[model samples]
Target: MLVTERTLAREIAPAVERSLPGVEVLAVEMLSPSRFCVYVDHPEGVDHALCARVTQLLDDYRASYTIDVSSPGVERPLRKPAHFRAAVGQEVQIRTATPLAGKKRFRGAVVAADERHLRLAAGDEAVDIPYEAIVRGNLIDEGQVQP
Candidate 1:
């Protein structure tokens, strides 16, 4: 089956949270067809033990993909509306599936976000990018978006 990255993330997020209380599945990335990375966090912060536990809980995925349970480091992926909302005032870099205003990439402080789109202040321009158009969007800073 051809599962989109977001589809995989949706499937894994709740599964992890339900199985391990307090654990939030931040983002699930399909690095390649057979490689996937799961970003997770907790109120107390993430540790090697936590990653191992998440890995264990996701044992079923090993049969299909190489799963890497990880901590959201300095640069974090923005996969949902909440992620963009929480990153308001934070700098981010994003790539769209197709060019917007003749540009496929953008970098700026997140000025606004709603379920449909995120607005950014890039230099002298205010760019609004639709979430559906985003191929990849990431906060490029010392990532600290309320866990």
Candidate 2:
């Protein structure tokens, strides 16, 4: 059986932790059948050396897939409850799998997040969106949206 993305992440996480303590693996994205992207972050920030080291350490998987290690950057993707929690009080953009309140897309400041849902304050409205309903979510920098 082919190794799934979650399995790959699980297998490589230990190595990353051993090599760079406090560096967290934020997300693993399969860009294509043969390409993968790994996002990593540290409190001190991620640099070229750290990314290169991560790429080198994951060499065992290189035969089947090309991996690119990267930092989360300014507009980081939010995939889990932990990620959402970190973005609380920050501007965010979310797209749901199905429409909620007559819309599938929402842009606002994240007011709170729990295991099941996140509350976003959009203007005078407060929208509560379930985690299961979210298709994509990312931090939105100031001035990125226009009135």
Clashing pairs in 2: none
TM for every model, in the order presented, reads: 0.89, 0.77
Instruction: List the global CA lDDT of all models.
Output: 0.88, 0.85
| lDDT of model number 2 | 0.85
Query: What does the lDDT come to for candidate 1?
Result: 0.88
Ten-residue region with minimum lDDT total, candidate 2 = 1-10
Q: Give the number of the best model, judged by TM-score.
A: 1
Residue 50's C-alpha lDDT in candidate 1? 97
- Residue 140 in candidate 1 has what lDDT? 81
- Once fitted onto the true fold, the runs of candidate 1 whose alpha carbons sit more than 4 angstroms away are 1-3, 142-147
Runs of candidate 2 with Cα error greater than 4 angstroms are 1-15, 97-104
Query: What TM value does model 1 have?
Result: 0.89
Clashes of 1: 0
